[model samples]
Target: MNINIKFPDNSVHQFPRNTTPLQIAENISSGLARDVITASVNGKLVDVNYPIQEDARIELFKFDSLPGKEIYWHSTAHLMAQAVKDLFPEVQVTIGPAIENGFYYDFDKDVPFTDEDLEKIETRMKELARENLEYKRREVSREEAIEIFRKMKENYKIEILEEIPPGEKISIYSQGNFTDLCRGPHIIHTGKIKAIKLLKISGAYWRGDARNKMLQRIYGISFPTSKELNQYLVDLEEAKKRDHRKIGKDLDLYSISDDIGAGLVLWHPNGAMIRNVVERYWIDKHLEADYKIVYTPHIGKSELWDTSGHLGFYRESMYSPMLVDEQEYYVKPMNCPFHIAIYQSQKRSYKELPLKYAEMGTVYRYEHSGALHGLMRVRGFTVDDAHIICTPEQLYDEVEKTLVFSLDMLRDFGFRDFKIYLATMPEKAVGERQNWDQATESLREALHKNKIAYEMDEGGGAFYGPKIDIKVKDSLNRLWQCSTIQFDFNLPQRFNMEYIAPDNQPHRPFMVHRALLGSVERFFGTLIEYHSGNFPLWLCPIQVQILPISENYEDYARSVYAEIRQHGIRAEIDLKSEKIGYKIREAEVRKIPYMFIVGQKEKEEGTVSVRRHTAGDLGSFLLQDIVKRLKEEILTKK
Candidate 1:
């Protein structure tokens, strides 16, 4: 029988029913077949060797594609696992999956993998890759699979097989002497992984459950060329230098103490000052934009959460309830419920439509202790949250305005490059289909009207509604998810939010949840890394450090500092009994933007020597002139 194959460009070609994707590629061009790693056969990812038995849509993937890279990395992971098994015969593999940047495999082993072990494993992986072993897949009956694993004494595989329903096909992939249970669309052979690097090793709980046994996880990445791998290594080193935790400590910005508990940040005076400045700027902009700022409590009653459906769908991330006056009160994981409560507090009118409520609300959520990072993943953080309550007619305009505002704010914060994602409803989403469709269409229309290009994330939205997620590119070219504007069709219907219409009837108001900066702590962390501790003059905690050459010049330095402070520049005098060079070095180490040096010549001439942190001396200038320049920069937020 002949089958029709549709290409991505909508071109169709006739082929035999048993023709594989590889054969189709080869018929087109040998180069395409050589580069093809995987394919989407009728929207289902499958190996190129899989037969096409019917007319279907086919999209072949090369290493340049995301799915192709995933397949390459996953196949490299299996190769690494094979090497580990070769080196350690007793280790049992549980699961190995591809992540955002790389892949990791968890092993059930008594002995933990060390740095030396990774080197050996990488060596072995290279040796195995040179052999160009083929990854062959076989489908077996559940009983046969269980018997195979049982005979091999791979208890983890046996346990996994028990969960599989009877009469279902269990796929097993084998390469050389290594075999694993997987649903794979891997690369044809291991030789494609030309450059490999085992990044690191860490302990991870089996299945991410605290109650489960801890397993050793080895993370690794691969590239098709040595040049790409080398460039990646360079980027990795730069990332370490820009790591927020290290920069935070070096700058004395924030600290996380064991006594204070993990995932909780204690911002020192410097960090607090930066945060205060950011908050003031945020508030001023919000007020200018006609946002009604409000404060909400950290906890809400269980009944309130029940009505909001947070207890039903989002309870896992929430803390356990606390008893207050015989009633259970839980710490809020989101500010939406409180905002809803405010909306429901009194009768609203359509004339008051598009009521923008903004808040820097702090909320607490439970994160796994192991999953917690420096400031990115925290238990408690403040969100620059806002809710826009509007009528159906106003939804599109409101969303568009929010999108423009969000992009403007991000650009102001030095994020010029962005990738926006329009996430559609998930399978488990709430609200009626009509509501979801309307909300999704509004978001799509906003993006289209604004001429903003965005990628669609199919079935990747929140349970409530569709959303627009903005990811900003940092200095290192790394993407960080920051802004989100989500429509909530479930909340208004659940709370029965009503506003008086022109016809004297109650109508539901559309609720939109927006967080342009996401969590303040996370944003601050990103800011630190983006600038590599060299914050702009406006955001720097210590804008100017006055360094006196000797104790005799302290008075002049103090006067210079006072004068700078008068111009609203954050300035401090270095009074420590240290040499001039030492003080200058210390100022540079602290990442102070400017340094005002005072000495006999400067004091006598009524001028201060100006030195930038990284840019040497900037000649001498009158204290007033220096202050004027600094004020101009600060006012301009340069």
Candidate 2:
């Protein structure tokens, strides 16, 4: 029998029914066969040896593709699990899956796996890979699966099979002496994995449910070539060096204390200063863009959230309501409801359409203690949030302005590359079909109008609306989720928001909720890692640290510092007991963009020796000339 297979590029090929992706790759080229790691048939990741029995779209994935890397790492996880079973037969494997950078496997065991155990597992995995074991998939009835695991004393596997819905197909992957329950898209054989490393081990909740049993999760990574694995290890080291938590501690920027509880951040003086600059820039930009600055209370009546549907959808993350005079009040998790109330204070007309309200809104969420990490994932943070209430005719312009504004803001802060995703409506979304269609079209048109290309993230929108999320890429090519523009239809109807049309009839206004920097805390964390603590002149808390060689020259250093400070530069005088080189090195470590060294000669000549944080000594300059150069760097607007 013949089956038509449509390639990712829409080209169709006829192949015999039950053909495998590996066979297809071999037909293309021996080199492609060697490089191909996985395949997706009609959007489902299946084993390279899995048979395609019917007409479908086939996407052959290499290591360069995201899905291909996922498959590679996932197979490595299975190998790790096999190794663990071989060494510790008492342990039971529950689940193993691939993540962003690698893969981890959850094991139900009496004892936790240690670093030595990880080393042994890595060795066993290498031995298994060298055996060139073929990954064979077998399908059995659910009852038969349970019986087989029960006979083997694999209670965990039996439990998993019992929990799965009846009538669903049960498939298991077998390699040599090890067999496990899995739905996989593994490479042709274990030998395809040439390089592997066990990274770490941690405790995880079984099935990710805290109420369930705990499991030991072993994390690992793999590559087709040792060179690629070596490069990955190097990148991992660089990422560790750039971790914001480490930099925060070294630079005295922010801290998370055990006494203060988890998910709460305490910003030091320097961090506060940087935050002030960021907020000031945000306010100035919004004002220049004709947005009205607004403020809202941190807490509001519980009824407000109930009306906005947040109480129903977001109750788990929200704090319990406070009772005052028998009425419950809740801390704000979002600023949207309050903004809507303000808009309702008075009647609006079509002429006042596209009313842009911008705010630095602080919100609180009940983040889990274990999940909290530095400023990147926190419980409390301020959002540089805004809402544009516009007529249908104004939707395009509003979205376009938002895109341009966000891009310009990122570029100004040293982020030049970004990944964009246009998310359409989800199956569970509210609003008329026509409304959703029109809103998605408006967002699409706006992106095209600005000449910004974006990929479609189908059904990846919020429950109330479609949206576009922009992930900014840093100097190290790390992607951080940032600016977002969400189009909401349910809010206007739920809040009864309206504007009088030209014909004097009240009509529903389109609501656009957007945030350029997303959360200020997350942005700060990304910025610290993006530049590795070397912030630009504009955002640097202490742009210039004046180092006086001795106590005698402190006065001259103070004078230069005051002169720069008066000109709106973040300048400071360091008069600590330290040598000139030591002080300079300290300032460089702190990531101060500029350092001015003051000595007897500099004081007598009214000159300051300048050094850049990243660049070495830039020679001496008159105090005024040094200020001028620093000012130019700060004022280089996007």
Candidate 3:
């Protein structure tokens, strides 16, 4: 029998049934056959060697594609596991999976894997790849799978086998002397992986549960060419230099102290100044956008959480309740409940529909110590949260406006590149199907209407509703999820929220929860990395630094500082008797945007030598003219 296969270019071809995707690629061109790593048969990803059984749409994936990379890294993980097992007979493989950048395999071993062991593993992986081992898959019954693992004395594999449903197909893949249980569409052969590198090794809990035994996890990356691998390594090194934790400490922006508790950030004067500027700008923007800002308590009664369904659905991340006058009060994990309360305060009418309430609400959440990192993941942080309660007719417009506002704000902060994701309802979600569909459509329309390109994340939305998640690319080209515009049909219904309609009947108003900067702490962390400590003039804590060449020029430096400060520029004088070069170097290290070097010539001429950090000297300018240029640059946020 012959089958019709539709290519991505809309070309249709007739081929015999059971013809593999690789054969199709070969028929097209030998170059394509060599380049194709995987294929999607009727939208389901499969190996390039997968047989074409019926009429289908076949999309071949190259090494550069996301699915292709995932398959490549996943196969690399198996290769790594095989190498580890070959080196250490006693080591047991628990689980291994592909991450965003690479892959990691966790091992249940007596001793931790060392750096020396990593070198051995990489050597073994390369040797194994050169062997050109074929990956063959076989399906087995659940009992057969259990028996196979039991014979191998792999307890982790047996435990995994027990979780498989009775009638489900249990597939295992074998390559060379190594065989493992996997549901895979792996590469046809190990030779496909050419260049391999073992990045690092770390400790991880079995299945991410701290209660489980700790396992040694080895991270690695592989590429078809050595050039790609080398480039990736270069990016990794640059990423370390831009690490927010290191920059945060170097700049004295923020700190996480053991005494204050982990995952809790203490912003120093420098960080606080930046935060103040961001807050002021945020408030001013919200006001201009016709959003009424509000303040809510950090703790709310247990009854309030119950009404919001947080006690039922989101209790795990919430802190334990405290008893106050026999009533339990819980630290707020979200500001939605309080916003709902405000809506319910008065009997709202249709005239009051589309009410927008914004807040820099601080909320607490219980984060695992192992999961916490600098400001990105914290126990307590302020969310740039807002709720827009509007009529169903106003939902689309509000969502579109919210998206536009979010992009404008992010752009103002120097984020030019953005990737938007429209996340739809998940399998376990609240709200009616109609409400979910309406919410998802609103987000889709918003992105489409704005001519913004986005990817659809099916079943990746919050339990309450669908959302538009905007991930901004930093200076390192790494994506960070910052803004979210979400709909909340569950909360409004749970709280029995209603408004008087035009027909004089009570109706449920649609609620939208938006966080332009998801969290102030996380956004600040991203900004630190994005700017690499050299902030824009308008956002810099100290816009200008006055340096005196010697003790004789101290008076002139002080005068210069005073003059700049009078013009509302954040100016500081380095009054210490340090050498001019040393003072200038210190100012540059501090990432001060401008340094006014005052010396004998400047003191006599009543002019200052201006030096821009990272740009070197800009010659000498009169104090008044320099102030005008500085003000203009700062105002323009250049």
Candidate 4:
């Protein structure tokens, strides 16, 4: 018997029945056979050794491809399981899967894994990889799976098997003496895992349920070659160097203390100064763009969430309600509800169709302890949120204008490269079919008209609407999600919002919720990493630091700094008794944009030696000249 295997290019190949994809690859080319790690059959990833029984479309995945990475990392996870079994034979492996960053394996070990154990396991993993043992996949009956794991005394595997649906064919992957309950698409052999390292160990609840047993999760990353591994390690080092948590502390920008509790950021004076400048600029730009600024309360009645349908879907991220005068109140997790309430406050007319309301609204959400990382993921943060209420005919133009506004603002913040994604209706959305179609089409047309290239995510939107998310690329080539525009039809109908038409008929209005700097805290953190804390003169908390030659020149330095400060420059006087060189170094370490050295010779002539933060020896200049140059740099938007 023969089977037809369709290639991605629509070409079909006749292969003998039960022929494996690996065998077919070998027939085509030995190079491809060696490189192919996995195969996608009819859009589902499967092991290369899996038998082909029916006609199906196939795509061979290499190490660089997404499916290839999945298989490689999945194979590496098997390697990790092997090492863990060897090191702790008493431990039971429940599950291991490949994640975005790498692979993680959950273990029911008697002892909690520590950094030392991770190092030991990593060393053993290298030894196992050296063996180059073949990874074999086998189909087993549910009863057989239970018996095998039972004989091995792996109760975790038994528990997982019991929950599997009846009559389901169970699969077991065995590499060396370690076997796991998994549906695998692993590499052909352990030799394919050339470069591997265990990164971290953390405690995770079984199946992510808080009530389940705590399992030790060992995270690791792997590559096919040493060069790629080395590059990854170098990138990790660079990320650490650019970590905002470290830079924020070194510069005294912000701090979080145990007394203040977790996920609550206490912005110091310096950080507040930078926030003030950014907020002021943001307000001016929105006003110039014909946006009306509105203020919303930090907390609202819990019933409001019910009307917005957030309570039904987004309750996990929301704070618990507080009883207030026989009513429940919630600290807002999103500003959309209040903005919608304002739109419903008055009877709207078609002449006011495209009413834009913008706000720097602060919101609070209960981010998990494990998920919170410095300012990037926080419990309390302000959103540069806005909403546009328009008629259906105005949908395309409104979306286009919002995209233009967001992209231009991001460019002004020095983010030039961006990737856009149009996320369609979700599986759990609540909107009429026609409304969903119209909103999705309008968003697509807006992107197309603006000449912005974007990829479509089949079902990545909220439970109420479709959306477009803009991910900005930073200096290190990492993408940070910064902007989002969502088209919501459910919210307007849920809140019973409407606007009067030209012909005196009331009808539902389309709602567009958008945020350029999605979360102010996260955006600030990304900016810190993108520029490595060397913010532009305008955004820098301390734009200039005045370093005097000694204590004798403190008065002169204060005068120079005062004059600059009077001109709206953020200048600080270093009046410490430290040497001039020491003060200059401190200024550089603080990432101050400019340093002005005021000494006896410079004080008499009303001149100061200017030194840039990164570029040294900017030489002597009149006080007024330096001020003019600094002001120009600040005034220039981009």
TM-score of 1: 0.78
Residues 1-638 of candidate 2: C-alpha lDDT, one tens digit per residue: 99999997899999999999989999899998989988988999888887899999998999999999998898888888899999999888888999887899999898898889989999999999999998888888888888878877887788789889887889988888888888775777899889998888889998788898889998889998999999999988887898888888998999988898788889998888888889998999999999999999999999899999889777888999999899999999989999999899999999998899999999999988776767878999998999999998888888998999999898888876688999998876677889888888888988888888899989878777889999865434566679999998889999999999999999999999999999999889888887788777787788888999998998898889888889998788899988988998888878888899999999999999999888989999998898888788889841
Give all TM-scores, in the order shown: 0.78, 0.81, 0.82, 0.79
Flag clash pairs in model 2. Answer: none
**Top candidate (TM-score):** 3
Clashes of 4: 0
Score candidate 2 by lDDT. 0.88
Q: What would the per-residue lDDT of candidate 3 be over residues 216-330, giving only the tens digit for each residue?
A: 9999999999999999999888888888888999999999999989888899999999999999999999999999999999999999998888888788899999999999999
Tell me the whole-model lDDT of each prediction, alpha carbons only: 0.90, 0.88, 0.91, 0.88
List candidate 1 segments past 4 Å from native. Answer: 1-75, 88-117, 129-195, 202-217, 222-231, 426-429, 456-460, 472-480
Estimate candidate 1's alpha-carbon lDDT, on a 0 to 1 scale.
Answer: 0.90
Per-residue lDDT value at 536 in model 1: 83
Better of 3 and 4 by lDDT: 3
Off by over 4 Å in 2: 1-74, 89-100, 106-116, 132-174, 180-194, 202-216, 224-231, 423-441, 448-460, 472-480
For every candidate in turn, the CA RMSD to the true structure comes to 5.9, 5.3, 4.8, 5.3
Pairs in clash, predicted candidate 3: none
Q: lDDT per residue, candidate 1, 250-357, as tens digits?
A: 999999999988889999999999999989989998998889999999998999999888898888899999999999999999999899889889999999988999
Clashes counted in candidate 2 amount to: 0
What's the number of clashes in each of the models? 0, 0, 0, 0
